[model samples]
Target chain A: MTIKDIVYIALFVALTAALGLMPPIAFAGGALPPITAQSLGVMLAGSVLGAKRGGYALLLFVALVAMGFPLLSGGRGGFGVLLGTSGGFILAWPICAAVIGHLVHKNANANIWVTGGMIAFGGILVMYTLGIPWMAVVGKLGLDKSLAIMVAYIPGDLVKVVLATVIARGLRRAYPNI
Target chain B: MLDLYTPGTSMLHRMSPGPKMAALAIAATALFLQESLLVTALAVVAILALYRVANIPMKTALAQIRPLMWIFVIFFAVQWYFSGLTLAAYVVLRLAALILLASLVTLTTRASDMIDSMTRALRLFKPIGVNPDKVSLAISLALRFIPVLGRIATEVREAQKTRGLERSIIAVAMPLAIRAIKMADDVSDAIESRGYRS
Candidate 1:
């Protein structure tokens, strides 16, 4: 409600959008292109904003897309894309945000690695679970192929998870309130 | 570096985070289910109206979207080239709508309030072996760090530029990485000192 909160929220929204500009990993012959640095923003939202606010930040981003802003990576947007092949992943943003927030809040004083892993795994599950089904239905791929394509994303996502964890933990050290 | 949120006092802002989230979920689902251009167009119009109702400044909204112009162009081109113009148009317009709507939400709500709402939602997961507290903490940490990382990145870039090493990835990246590592260590210590548990 205060000016500071408004300022921070605005900053995070821009940060999330800007980070989306990071080049996505293009896998040859895969069902989907795994975006690099995508989850970094997601993790950042949760870790910094805490459980509820973190998810809200992401929700804010998703709402923008629903309202027709081309803020997603690669300039994709609109309701149609949401129904397209990657709709599932798009839909998973809020859930992932909540999961990341919850994990970090619960282990507020835990080791960075454990907290990081929890957030990463939670994110991975949300994206993949939502993404695979859409891949199957929209892309017309079977479960096996959908799973295979989804699997290609794990390595790249893991790297993001680690980075998010490190950066978040580091920021906490630098600023106690965060 | 860009501030995309426009301050507003729309009904959306007054709406609780929980209901707003639910609405988004429902709308997103509807979007995915309806592939008709008519439906998509309607959705776009509805989002714009929400912006108006929310009292977001038009100039501010447009400015927020300006940076993304290039991405939209690239996507339009790629989709056009590979999937034809019609599909490209559809995809671009749809994505644009979503982004704008999200901007509206962020512009109105406070980050801390959003965090609290999420923590409450996840508390239901406690019975499923999930700890809402820990999860929320991690999310808070990540969200809080985004700006810090951005600041660190900018500082590193500036430092590199001063030495005429701006063009070198190593010059910018190395220090950023080092600082990030140091940051992680500090976070762990702070959490422990605060008497919080993992």
Candidate 2:
């Protein structure tokens, strides 16, 4: 990789950390509950950086979390987190980013709707495919229970897909070669 | 900019990064695997004592756990609801012990020393196409950028708020992405100017 590639990767990693600082957004009288802004960072990394580099960026972020930086939402990190209930979701970040990046790369020049679809597929579908089952096993809540709990976050995650799609489209327009 | 390391001459501060990291991993795993609540509570007290030994002030130690207060409360509530008070207490105590142990490592080790140890550890993968130097540089750069990007996020949020777009995620996200990309370009150029080839 060139110096530019490294910078891009590092930049996304930092972006992920920055997004963790965002306060959780609560809606629907707390029935739907608060959803974290951190995962939006994963979507943005992939949508902006593309597969390999995006994956690397998230991988590096996870490594830093493992290294004891309180980079995760609510300033949680370390092996304690990786072994916790949401460990699967945390571990799936790199793969989730790569999946979104790969789809975005294929759909270059696509419209907003198409981009949103790809983000939803890769970010939401791919992530929960790994995350839910892991939550079930780690939390010992069973698959059905885990799915039930995690489903509530989908609406919030969809909002992130839309936001990432819009931001990535604007980014492409501003810097065509990026 | 927000480095957790505190310079000192304590035993933990003098310990090498590799062994300290290893000890943390082992201790954390052991804490999780054990089933005794009393042992976990003792471990928490032990970690606090170690913090005192390392001269980390009580306020600083409390600060480390502050951001996680809500998370702990949620976890405790849920666990209590499902498994009763004892199980909940065990879970939270174990978690606190693990987090404190991990933070202790970061508190004592310099960022450069930690990165150097990682680089040295990664050298074993050199034959598998890993470039230890580049990986180390990327890790360090990512660490350095975390606080900088955090400041940027704050600035972008305020900038969007002035335009009456404070509640819009897109408004803040767009500016943040653009600024981050620009910064990346400038950083890469600076690195290249300094004779960095990769």
lDDT of each: 0.65, 0.83
**Best candidate (score: lDDT):** 2
Model 2 stretches astray by more than 4 angstroms: A27-34, A137-145, B144-168
Q: Evaluate candidate 2 and give its CAPRI docking class based on DockQ.
A: medium
Best by TM-score: 2
lDDT of residue B145 for candidate 2: 86
lDDT of 1 by residue, B21-83 (tens): 567667766665776767788888898888788887687557545645644665566567766
Give the per-residue lDDT digits (tens) of candidate 2, residues A1-178: 8888898999888888878777878776765447888888899889889999999999988987877677887776665577666789999999999999999988897888999999998889989999999876655456886788778899989888888888989999998877
Determine which window of 10 residues in candidate 2 chain B has minimal summed lDDT. Answer: B67-76
TM-score of each: 0.54, 0.87
Per-residue lDDT over B15-72 for candidate 2, one digit per residue giving the tens place of the 0 to 100 score: 9999998898788778867889899899999999999999999887787777667556
How many steric overlaps are in each model, in order?
73, 0
Summarize candidate 1's per-residue lDDT along A62-172 as a digit string, tens digits: 754543445577654444446555678877877787788888878889897798778776678877887788756654345676686577678878877876777667666
